[model samples]
Target: MVMKAPVADARNGSVVDRLVGIDLARGLAVFGMYAAHLGPDPGEGGLVGFLMELTHGRPSALFAVLAGFSILLITGRKAPKSGIAGRQAIARVAIRALVLLALGSILGCLGTQVEVILEYYGICFLLVLPLHRLSAYQLGLIAAATALVLPQVRSSLLSVAPNLLDPVFNLMVNGYYPAVTWVPFLIAGMAIARLNLNTLAAHWRLGLAGVALAVLGHGGSLLALSSRALTETSLWWSDVDGAFEPSKSSFIVKSSWIAAPHSETTLSIVGSTGCAMIILAACMLAVDALPRLRKLVWPIIAVGSMSLTAYVLH
Candidate 1:
C-alpha cells in the first residue's frame, strides 16, 4: 500500500513511512484550501468558480482524515507499538498537539477571515491518543457511530452551552471545523490505514464504499428534505457565493437534514468524507495504473510531502 520512506538513523530509532497517494491527497487539500481561501468567488470564476465552491468544506475534512491516517502511521503502521516505543509515540503526539494549539491560538488572534483549524486539530490529536491502537473494525465502528451520533450531541450541547465551558471548548463544539463531527473523519482515516490498502481489491472496495457514502449523504439529505415538505426555496444556495454574505455566515439549521458546509450536520460530514475517500482512492489507483504518472505529478507529490509547510506559507 505505501512505500517505506528512507530515513537516516535517529537515536530514538523511529522511521516514517510515506504513501504517494496520501501525499497526493494532502497536496490537493492544500490547493483546495488555496482555492477556498484565495481563488475567485464561485459566482465569478464560472466553472473554475464552481470547482472552488466544491472545495469549500470538503478539503478540511480530507485534511482531518489524512491527519488521522498519519497519526496511525506514526504510532505504528499495522500494529500498535508497545512498552518503550509506545511511550515515545505518546510523547511525540502530545508535544505535537501542544505546539499546534499554541500556533493555532496565535494565528486566531490575527483577526483573519479564514477560520483557524490547528487548535481543533490539536484537540483531536489529544482525543485520538487513546484510540490510536484500535483495530480497523473497532475504529470503523466508532467512526460510524460518531458520524451518526455526534452531530446531534453537538447540537444539543450547543443549545445548552451559552455558559457551560471555556472558549476552546466552544471552538471544538461550534467553530468552523468542530471536533465533534470532524473527529469521525479522522477515525475513518485511521481505520482505513489499518487495512492493507495496497491491493487492487482494497482500492475498488474503498471506492465503492465512497460512492455508497456519497449517495447516502447527498441522497439522504434530498430524501429528508422532500419528506419534510421542505424544498430548495427554504434553503440557502451557493456555499462559495455565500462567503461574501456576512449575514449568512452564521447559518440557521432549520433541521438535521440540512447538509450545508461547515454545518457539522451528519449528512454534511458523510458527504465530505465520501468525497475524500473517492479522491484518495482515485489518486492511489492512478499512480498504480500508470507508474509514469507518478513522476509527472512529482510537484504535487512534493507539495503533499511537506503539507504543513505548504499550508502555513500559503
Candidate 2:
C-alpha cells in the first residue's frame, strides 16, 4: 500500500510514480458504490443499515474528490500558469468532459435505478477550469465558500424554478448529487493535492482536521434538531404512514439547519466532505504503514487504475 518515494526523472526532474494508496482508496469507493447500487437494501436500522447509511453519500463524494486529484495529475501536478501547454491541457479536459457527458446520457437512457454521476461530473470539470490556476489556499477558500453558500442558493433557486422544468432544476439542485453542492469536493481534493501528503505528519493533520469538521457538522445539526425553536411545531415530526419511512425529510425548510444524510443540505455537504477527507487520510496512512500489503491488494489497485471503465461497466 505504501507509495514508492517519488522518483525524479533525469530528463524532467518531475516526480514520475503512481501513489498506490490513492488507487486503493478509489477501489474502496468503487466497491462502496457497488454495495450502494447492487446490494440489497439493508432496510432502516441495524448494523447493516447503519453501515449502509455511512456509505450512502460519502462514496460518491470520495469519487468526486478523486476526480479533482486525477484532473491535477492529468493537467500537470504544478500549475501551468498560462501558455500553449495550459491551453492544450484545458482542451483535453473539455474533451474528456464531453465524452463523460455522452456516456452518462447513454447510460441514463437505460432507466436503471442508479443515478448517473458522469454528466454532472463533466459539468463540474468545466466549472473548475477557470480556477485551475489558483493556489491551493485559494482553492480551499473557494471550496469552503461553495460548501457553505451553494446549498442556500440552491434552496432559493428550487423554490422559484418553474415546476414544469422541475427535472432540469432537480439536476442542478434537488436531484441526487447536484453539481452545485458536489463541486466543493472537487475543489477540496485539488487543495489536498497541493499539500505534502507523502509525510505521515501531513496525513495525521489532515485526519484530525477531518475529524473536527465531522464533529462540527454533525454536532451542529444535532443541536439544531433538538432546539425548542424547531421542535415547537409538528413540522419536525414524521408525517408518513409507513414504518420504514426515512427518518430524514426530503423537503428543505428555510429554517431547517439539521444535517440529513443524502439530503444535499449544507451540513450534509460539510459532513460528507469530512468523511471523504478521513477516508483519504486513512488510505494514505494504511499504505505508508503497511507497504507489503500493496501486493496483496494489487487487483484492487488495478480496478482503481481503470476506475472510469469499471464505473461504466458496473
Candidate 3:
C-alpha cells in the first residue's frame, strides 16, 4: 500500500513534506561521501578497495540526482506552482543557490582534498528556474540531449581554445560538476518527480529503467572499448585526443564511450543516471515495503534532512 504523507509547509520556508525514502537516500549520500572522503583508498586492492571505489562517483552522482528531486520538492512536486506562489518559490531557490555558492566558495578556499560541489550545485539551481516549468518528457529529452552532446561540445571548444580558463566557463562546462553535462542528473531527478511515484507499478518501472540504462551504458562502453582495441580505430565521443596513448597501443585507440566515474562520457552519464535512479527507486520501495524500517534508519533520515549542514560541517 502507498503511504500518503500529509503536506506541511515549514516556517523556515524549506520544504517539509518530504518523501522519507528520499531523505533516506540523501542520508546515504551524506554517509557515502564520508566513506568516500575518510575510507581507505580504492588502490588498496581487495573487497575493501572495491567497496571504497563504489563510494567514489556514485554517491556524488546520487547526490546530484537528489539535488534535482529537492528542486522539485522546493518548488512543487509533480507540478510547478503558478503565479505568485511560483515567483516566491523561484526566489527562494535563487537565494538558496546563492547561499550554497558562497558556502562552497568559502569551503573551497580552505584547500581541502575534496572538491567542493556546493558552488556548482548553486549554479545548477539558478539554471533550473525557467527549466522547472518544462514537462517531464521535455526535461527528459533535454537531459538526454545534453548528456549525449554537451560534453562533446565542451571538449571540442576546449581543444580549439585550450585556454578557456574563465571562471564561468570552468563552472558551467569543465568543473567537478559541470553544469553543461551534469545538469542532466538534476533534470533526470526532476523527471522522476513528475512521474506517479506513489504507485508500485511506477516504482517497478523506475527500477527497471535504471537496470536497462545501466546495462546499455556500461555494456555499450565495454563493447566500444573492445572494438577500438581490436580494430585500432579511435572512435570517440569524449576528448579522444586527451586520452589517446600512442605508446600503450602502437596504433592509437580511443572508444566512443567510457563508464569510468566522472568521465562525463555518454555511457558514464547514462550509467550514473541509471545508478542514481536505482538507488532512488530502491530507497522508495524499501520505505514502502517496510514502513517500520523508517524507525530503524531514523539517524540516516535525520542526516539527510540536514544534508547541507552535514556537508558543510564535513
Candidate 4:
C-alpha cells in the first residue's frame, strides 16, 4: 500500500499551508549559511569546529536545491502555465535574477571575506529557465547527466581556458560555485517536487535513496583516496596533512574526488546532493509527524518565507 498524507490542492489555500515544510527547510538553510559565514572557523579543532565542518557544503547545496523548488512553486508547481501567463511568469523570474545579480555584484565589491553566492545564483536562475518546462523524469535524467559528466567537461575546459575572467570559464570552471556543477541540485529539487511528497511511502523512499546515494558517493571518495595511483599522481600526502591542520584556510575534505569543500567535483556534487535530499525528506516527514510543533517552528517558517531578503541582509 502507498501510505500517504493529504495532498494540497495546487490552486487552494495560502502558500504556507501547501508547503510549510519547504519554507522551514529554507529557513534552516539560511541559518546554516549564517553559521558558515559568522560562526567560528571549523579549522580551530573543537566541538564548534566539528559542527561547522558538518554544515559546510551541505547547507549551501540545500539552498541551491531549494531554489529550484521555489521556482516550481512560483511557476504554478506541477501545473505550469502557457501562453500569456507563462511569458509573464518568465519575465518575473528574469527580473528577479537581474535584481539578485545586481545585489550580488554590489555585495562582492564590499570586500567581505564571504564568497557571495548571489551572483552565481542569479545566473543559475536564468540558465534554468529553458528547463522549467521539463517533466520530473526528464529533469532527473538531466540532473544525473550533469553530476556524472559536467566535472570531466570542466576539467577539460579548465585545461584550455585557465583565465578566470572568461565568462564561460568563470561560470563552469573556477567560480565560487559553478552553475554547471550546481545545476544538478536545482534540477533534482524540481524533480523531487514533482513527486508525491505528501505520503509516508514517498518520503521513506526518498530518504532511503538519499542515504544510499550519500554512502555511495562518500565511499567512492574514500576509495579514491586509498588508491595508490591517485595518491602518487596528486598532492595527496600534503592534502591529507592539510586536512588535519587547524587553520582558517585549511581544506575540509567532503568528497574523495577533491578535498576542497567547494571544488564542484562530480563526487562532491553527488555527496552534497544526497545530503540535501535527506534534509528535504526529513523536513517533509517532520511536518507530518509533529503537527503540534508547528507553533514552535513558526519562526523558522517566517525566516524561510523571507529568505531572499534575509539572505541579502546577511
Candidate 5:
C-alpha cells in the first residue's frame, strides 16, 4: 500500500513536502524492478518463476498508476482554484516527463533490463496532461478500452507486417503494454487519486469493488490463456519468419503475457493492473495496522521519490 500523504505540510506547507507516501510508492516500485532484474532467472515451471512473474515485470504498472495519481494530486488542487496555477502544474509535469524520457534514453544504452520502463513511463507521463482533465468515468472508459484494444491492435499490426513486428518496436507495437494501452491505466489512477481516496475509508465499497474487479479481471485472463495453450509463441513466431503462432508447452505464455524478445501478453494486462490495486489496498491496510513499519518504508519511499533518476541510473 502506498503511504497516505498528508493534505499539506505543517512546517513549510510545500506540496513536495506533502508527497512522502507517493515517493515511497514510486521508490518501492523501482526496488521491485531491480530485484526482478538482478535476481537469478526463475525457470519457466518453477515457483521462483511464478514469483518473478508477479514482481519482476509488474511493478511498472504501480509506478505508472502512481504517476497518474501524482498528476491529480498536484494539478487538481490548483485547477479549480486558479487557472494560472493549473497551467504551471501541467508544465511541471511536462518537464518531468521530458527529463525522464531523455534520461531513459541514456539508461537504455547501458543494456540493462530496466531500460524499457523508463522509456515507457516517460511516455506515459507525457500522456497524463490531457487525461488529467478527464472525468473519472471517462478515465475508466479509456482504461478499459486500451487494455482490450492494444493486444488486438498489435495482433493486427503483426499480421499486416510481420517484419516490422520486431523488438525494436516493442514499446509501441507489441505487448506487455505499448504506449497506447498503458496511459489509460495512469489516467484511471489519476481518477482514483482525484477522489480523495485516502479520506474515503468510510466507504469500503470502492475498495471492495476494486478487489472484485481485480479478481475477476486477473482470473479471467489466466483462464483464457490456459484454455488457448498459447503459452509460448516466441519460438513459433521466430521459426515461421513471417507468421506468428503460439506453442502449448512454451514458457512465454505462462510466464509473460507479452511475447519474447519482450515477454508481454494479454494476461499481463490483467495481472499487472489487478495486482497493483490489490497490493495497494493491502499496503494501505498493513500500514494502518503497523505503525512501526513507517520507518522501514523510508528506503522504498526514497526510491519512489527519485524513481525516474534511479531508473535512469539502473
Candidate 6:
C-alpha cells in the first residue's frame, strides 16, 4: 500500500515522477477481476458470491477514478500554458481509446472469456474527452448525473430499442457498464483533474473525506440493497444458461451465488466501499516504506499503469 515518494524531476528516474499508487491500485484491480471471474462461480446465495458481490465491481470504479486523475495530472500542466497540454491530452486519450476498442473487439471475438472491459474503458475515455474542458465541479456534477441516469437510460434503450441499438451501442449499454456505469467514475476522475486532487494527498482533511466518502458510498449502497430487495424490482433477469455467459461477462462472473436479485445492491455497496478504501489506502499506505514496496509492487503497479494495455490484451 505504501507508494514511493514523488520525485518532481521527471527527467530523473523517480517513482513519484510516475503515478505509483495508481499503478499499484491498477495491478490490484486487474487481479481482482481475474480472481472474481476466473475462479469458481459464486452462486447467488453462496459465501463466495457474497465476497464477489462486495469486491468484484468495486475496483474498476477505483481504477476509473484514477484514470481520470492520471489524465488530468499528466495533461493539466498545459492548462496553464496554452491549453496545448489539454489538446495533446485529448489526442492521447483518443488514440488510447481507439486501441482499446479494437482490442476489446478482438478479445470478445477470440477469447473464451469474452468479457472485455477494454471496450468500456475505451468508451468511458471518449466520454470524458469533452468533459475535460469543464471545471472540476462541473465535471463532478455531470458524473453524478450520469451515474443516476446511466442504469435507467440503459434499461430503456435496451428494452425499447434493441434493434436500433447496434453492437457498439450494445457494447456501451448492456455490454460493459451495466448498472454501475463507468462513465461517472471517469467523470469523477476528470473532476479531480479539473481540480488539483493530487495535491490534496498532502491534506489530512481531504484524505479523511476520501475515507468518509468511501464508507458512505459503499455503506449506503449496502443499506439500499438490503432495504430495496431486488425480488421486488421489475428488471430482475437471469441468464439461466448454467454456463458462463461471455456475453454477460462483466467484472463479476455469472454465478448463481451472487446472481440473485438481492445481490445487485449488495455488490454495489460493497464494491463502492472497497473502491473508497483502496483509494484512501493507496494514498497513505507507505509514506515511509513506499520506495521499497514500490519495487515489490512495480509489476503490479505496471499492470495498474498500463490498465488499458492489460484490458486490451485480455
Task: List TM-scores for all candidates, in order.
Answer: 0.90, 0.86, 0.89, 0.85, 0.77, 0.71
Compose the digit string of candidate 5's lDDT tens values, residues 281-309: 55555555566776878777666766767
Deviation from native of the Cα of residue 214 in model 6, angstroms: 4.3
TM-score of 6: 0.71
lDDT scores in order:
0.79, 0.74, 0.79, 0.74, 0.60, 0.55
- Cα distance off (Å), candidate 1, residue 83: 1.1
lDDT of 1 by residue, 1-314 (tens): 44334543366577645778888888988898888888777767678877777887888889998999888887886998889999898888889889888888888898888888889998898888799889999999999999999999998988888465677767678677887778999999999889889787788888889988888887777777677664342222225444323365343453667665786778878877888899988888877777888889878888888887787676
Which is better, 4 or 6, measured by TM-score?
A: 4
Query: What ranges in model 3 sit over 4 Å off?
Result: 1-15, 230-255
Model 2 error, position 116 (Å):
0.9
Please provide, for model 3 over 85-196, each residue's C-alpha lDDT reduced to its tens digit, 9 standing for 90 to 100: 9889888889999999999899999999998889899998888667888888898898898888877886676667656788888888768778777888888888888777
What C-alpha root-mean-square deviation, in Å, does candidate 4 show against the real structure? Answer: 4.9
RMSD of each candidate? 2.9, 4.5, 4.0, 4.9, 5.6, 6.4
Question: TM-score of model 2 relative to the true fold?
Answer: 0.86
User: Between candidates 2 and 5, which one is better according to lDDT?
Assistant: 2
> For residues 189-252, could you state the per-residue lDDT of candidate 6 as single tens digits?
6665455434434434445656665555545544543455633221122222322233544322
- Which window of ten consecutive residues has the lowest lDDT sum in model 5? 235-244
Superposed by TM-score, candidate 6 places the C-alpha of residue 19 at a distance from the truth, in angstroms, of 2.5
Clash pairs of candidate 6?
A: 2-286, 6-16, 43-256, 43-257, 43-258, 44-256, 44-257, 44-258, 44-259, 45-257
lDDT (Cα, tens digit) per residue for candidate 4, span 1-314: 22222344556543333477787789999999999889887768778777877677778889999988877776756777789988887888888889988998899899999988888888888888778888888988998898899877776776676575876568556797888788888888888876767677888888888887776666566667666344322222123224422252333232336523476677778777777888878887887788866678888877887898998899
lDDT of 2 at 157: 76
